[model samples]
Target: MSPTTDADLSDFVFVRRNDGLPIEEIPFELVERKGVGHPDTMCDAIAERASRYYSQYCLEHFGRIAHHWFDKVMLFGGESDLDYGHGELVNPYTVLFAGKGAHRCGDTPIPLADILRRAAADVLSEVTTGFDADRHLVIDCRIVDHQGAGRGRSRYRPESHDDLVAIGDPSLVSNDCNLLHAFAPFSRLEQAVLRIERLINGPDFKARHRDTGWDVKVFGSRNGEDFSFIVNMPFLASDISSFDHYLSRKAECREEVVGLLRDTLGGDPAVLFNPTDRNGRPYLTALGSVADTGDVGAVGRGNRVTGLITPMRAMSIEAPAGKNPLDHTGKLYGVLAQQLARRLNEMTGKPVETHLFTSKEAPLDRPDQVVVRVHGLQDGGDEEQKIRAVVAEALANTAELTREIIVTGVTMW
Candidate 1:
């Protein structure tokens, strides 16, 4: 597809709605974020990294990305024992790699299982320090070579590079019917929740506080201008000396988080940590994540592509993790919707929600319908024209979008 011109604008719909209230003023808003080491987030990370490695291999060897989607990963937690100053994982965690991928191009075989295992190890090592991936993690590959539902066998089991349709037509064709919806200009409470999570998981915070674990979950609710958070943060058992020490460390961490939230939201918000803590029991873990024990997680159950699950704003049920970066509308459209909404919001100085819809085999650049809604829009004519330009340009440059997703490892969790 060529650069978008005036003619390309006709395919999209742009409207201005002034009735919808901004998220903060809407009375009741809810947002949840699963941190880096949460089991669900772990599955998302492993699956997406697996896809990235697979795509890179295909591009380096065959000059194009082969068909692959590893979005069905699962992490089954292992058995563990923990005390105030001692912890150990007796059984290793098991990561099951599911979905399908092209295993060969003509006679050249692809080492897909090895690539996936390496990807899992790389991500797991970065997220946890108590467990060694080579010794304490088991990587299993149940990924197959068959495309599900209506697609033919050759799609995932292609015999040659010529069978990879996307290689011939750089403007990839959508593999499924999907909808992508996203909004921009996060409210004060939403921004505060994100900032709090980052503050706790950041490197500087980790350096100062060694007792804190990575399996943090932040849940925030806002009623009008008042915001409150219930955070599930785990403490490393090996770092705490006694019950009093655990309580003291938690108090310090809570103070730091509340300070950050007050600065970000410009108000005093209530922050609670480990509500389940009792007289002699606290939230403690061996490997920083609950997954070091018997807890399990599956993909598509964690945070959305924006890194938070916001029910108050426009959201999609679709999960973008592990989908092919080239032709999978499930991944591409979601990422693009976010970018478009932010651009329009910045341009119009109003909140924006972008929705893109497409069907099976549709061209990547052209969706079946494109809807751009500007909340609290001041005027229509010229603003709508500008919105159309943004949509048209995005639709015309999907090839570049795919490249960015592959190279940068676009955020899906």
Candidate 2:
């Protein structure tokens, strides 16, 4: 059964459908989660933090978040030499920050350099342990003041703080034509992967096992009832004394993770930790991350807003990080779709998927399409009405959504 078009309004075409398959019922599923210390994720984190800091600075000085976009960020891994028990950084990691931002409000400077440095330092410190951003990383700022071609003029280089007052538009509009999809109730396998990674990176596990590194990636595949996970986790070189010591630590960590999987799924799932480990070489690093070991990364190449990269599910290719919180539907709609999906699911007690799309420069509250798929949608006629009411209410409150995003620093990558 396919979903039917329920309501077609002027601003949005709402489609409510049944026969949507739950993720678990889907025969095959693939979910990947890039850990915080992964270079790509690191870039996303830094970009988002920078945007938040920039927003705060503008709000404090100009009374609103000025027009800016800091989505382009790259982490060029440094060179590091490693052995069984020792590691040395030959060169420091380079964080190349490239994007457009508000450099000045009239004659007053926005202190972009100070904002970027603070953002990068804070994120790097939080993501990795035993690593100092100042000592082990170089910050490069290539941000400029410019907007796209048809945007009238360069809002980034505004004439005065007064010019920035209208930058946060009262009528929030989409900056780009983009689509976002989100669903509620993560599948059991998805939950398992999230839990496993959180455990590995959490403080208690880090305290218990000092050799574990934070640069972890979990790839989970499910075919029918059987599930398997390939976790690429790094081991700190300084914690291992010899080959035997490395094996012992690796074995211990694997056992713990296996136990976690078993507990999560209520079944023994096949688990492999650091499958790339060989005799002469191990998945070892100095600062608990491959980002400092010649591995490069950029934004939009990592996880989606839901924190997992699920190729099997409805997804958007847009990277939401660093976009302005006020009107960029790339960021706002992505977060809104997920929130609406969760709320609808909770309200109807059914698996719900929400997709929102808009045209470039369209009002944020007026999306071109809002497709809601409820697994048991056919059971009730009022469900469609409820869905419309919910979506309409949420859309009407997009201003609040923007405020929430700025205040909470909602995660979207």
Candidate 3:
């Protein structure tokens, strides 16, 4: 066969190796996920939404999305005075939005600060729901460079909108070498934990249980056949009147949660609820997230781009938040690796670990290196071909992922 071109991706190589043991033989595994209410997850979410919304606004008004990635976002938690059944924010959260973008589309200047404020407010309202935007949140925007930066820096095309006809794709390949990895078939424990969290934060859950807050977290560990799950959730004091009521609610939540998990997964996983505090005082929060009382948040420090934090997996520590969804391989590779891992596992019907690396300016269609490690496939023959096909299919969705991320802005919960 001939060499593969950039668009064709025919030259891509896939290296596979045995995982030394069968998937079912593995003894222990652990997985963790930071909920949307986590400080770090909040930072990722706010920055991502801000960039995506601004890009959309520009695209609609100027015919092209102006370049901007507000990755460097900081949230300073403020004070909240609270008691059993009542609470109020003594000071609101202070958020700083710092990044570069085109402030002007021709002579008409874009509403820069307005965009920032709206973005921050909208994101907090959507992600951290029930949090008071006007009274309890203070958001500010500081553009790193008001002057236009290069396209690769922020993925802003150099050709002006006025510059009539143009050549090929306006976007360029990744400007830096990015390495990312993910594992196949999320453990049953991981899925169970995520489902419980989404349930707690969902509208139906809230409607039924008004006292339950949205800021919730899930951590799971497995020891042979035994499993342990730790859930951290706070209750709103205003919803419940007395200390007895608080304890009663807590007991009810614990029982129901344990029963739900047992029924859903058919396992005797020990469920621990809010073990951090036993001082007779219930954990109360004015909002769903922990940003209420001096919790800090930073980009890339929260969940992986796939929304689950698998400490055991060979995943990247780099934060994929606030990058241009269209061209930043940092974020794209994270999603790509995850999809490839799932497909490879389905192909071989075994636990799979997939890794992909791309050099600076390399075509996004092809990776500089691709590695697939399977945990004991029954048959080694034809595995390589099947793995390669799976990778090719995953890479093929690069454009689609880019478009979805840039346009819709996928959130990590």
Q: Estimate each model's TM-score.
A: 0.96, 0.94, 0.88
What is the per-residue lDDT of model 2 for residues 367-392, given as tens digits with 9 covering 90 to 100? 78888888877655777787887887
Candidate 3 stretches greater than 4 Å from native: 1-12, 21-24, 146-159, 162-171, 376-383
- Cα RMSD for candidates in order: 1.7, 3.6, 3.5
| Candidate 2 overall lDDT versus native | 0.83
- Candidate lDDT (C-alpha), each: 0.83, 0.83, 0.71
User: Which parts of model 1 are misplaced by more than 4 Å?
Assistant: 4-8, 147-153, 165-171
What is the Cα root-mean-square deviation between model 2 and the actual structure? 3.6
Q: Which tens-of-lDDT digit does each residue in 272-293 have in candidate 1?
A: 7888886567888888899888
- Comparing 1 with 3 on TM-score, the higher-scoring candidate is 1
Q: Is candidate 2 or candidate 3 better by lDDT?
A: 2
lDDT of 3 by residue, 99-205 (tens): 76666655667777887777777767765546777787787777754434343322233245542111114344664688988887777767777777877777777
124, model 1: CA deviation in Å? 1.2
lDDT of model 2, residue 313? 86
- Which segments of model 2 are wrong by more than 4 Å? 1-13, 165-168
